[model samples]
Target: MRRTLLALLLALPLAAQAAAPSALKAEDVPSLLKPPAHGVRVLALWSLDCAYCESNLQALLKLQRAHPREIELIAVATDSVAQQDALAQRLHAAGVDALPARAYAEDTPDRINYLLDPDWGGELPRTLIIRADGKRSGISGQLTPDKLATIAP
Candidate 1:
């Protein structure tokens, strides 16, 4: 009975993780995740408050003008709920939809550090590009429109 219960407990989180969401928190950044309809894997991770992040966001917004449904843009914010609310209002005022970005919770020190960084202890303004089949191209600090497009699967 004990072993079975333990096994079931272990399996619970796997079930939750496998629900396969369009967005999942990666440490500090909320990742825009979607399986390629054509078997291509692609993902982007980013934070707010970084100049490079801002440029990246602009490029992404521009890209969305043409391909909003093609790529999933999950802009993860590390700010408090109040701060994120204000930011969301600003985005709404600019006519940017909330679907592109969402607030990521840093619920624990380890998760927060991983989301931010351990090497540089950086926060905000990060992007992770993952390929189809779960192969990753690596994460970037700042990205341009061209650069962002270059990682498309």
Candidate 2:
């Protein structure tokens, strides 16, 4: 029983690591947006402080649920590394903590923002849609249901 208990304790950290969201870097943006063999990649950039981010997240979640297989939603938080715990909590509250996500891991997020999109201006509630063919469309501000439908469709 002691041996079994030790093994379980060793596995606990691994399990927690597997469940935690990953830290995103500026260099990681390209790979994250790479189109899958099938379906479009939807990248949503938000922050817990953004007033409209929750609504945008809800809309994205709805879109994801509608086309579970055809659309892949990835959330990026434009928050500092120090806010990681709170970021995770906010994502949980928004019902997207389970989605593949990342928080800014750099002290200068503008560099990461530029890597994400040269014209983005680091705006909150930004969404990017990458088609299977590699074409990308980006929009800043909360995504409307109509816009979400058009992208997912």
Residues 1-153 of candidate 1: C-alpha lDDT, one tens digit per residue: 999999999997664333222223453243333344543333333443555655666666666555655555555555543355455654444444343455544345346546444443444455544444654444566665567676554
With a 3 Å backbone cut-off (N, CA, C), the pairs that clash in candidate 1 are 27-115, 28-115, 41-131, 41-132, 75-101
With candidate 2 superimposed using the best TM-score fit, by how many Å does residue 124's alpha carbon deviate from the native? 1.2
How many clashing pairs in candidate 2? Answer: 0
- Which candidate comes out best when scored by TM-score? 2
Give all candidate RMSDs, comma-separated: 12.5, 3.5
Candidate 2 per-residue lDDT, tens place, 1-153, comes to: 999999999997675454345788877888987877778888888987899988887888888888999998888888875676677778877777677778888888998888887878887889988889888889788777678777884
Give per-model TM-scores: 0.55, 0.84
The whole-model lDDT of each prediction reads: 0.49, 0.81
Q: Model 1, poorest ten-residue lDDT window? A: 16-25
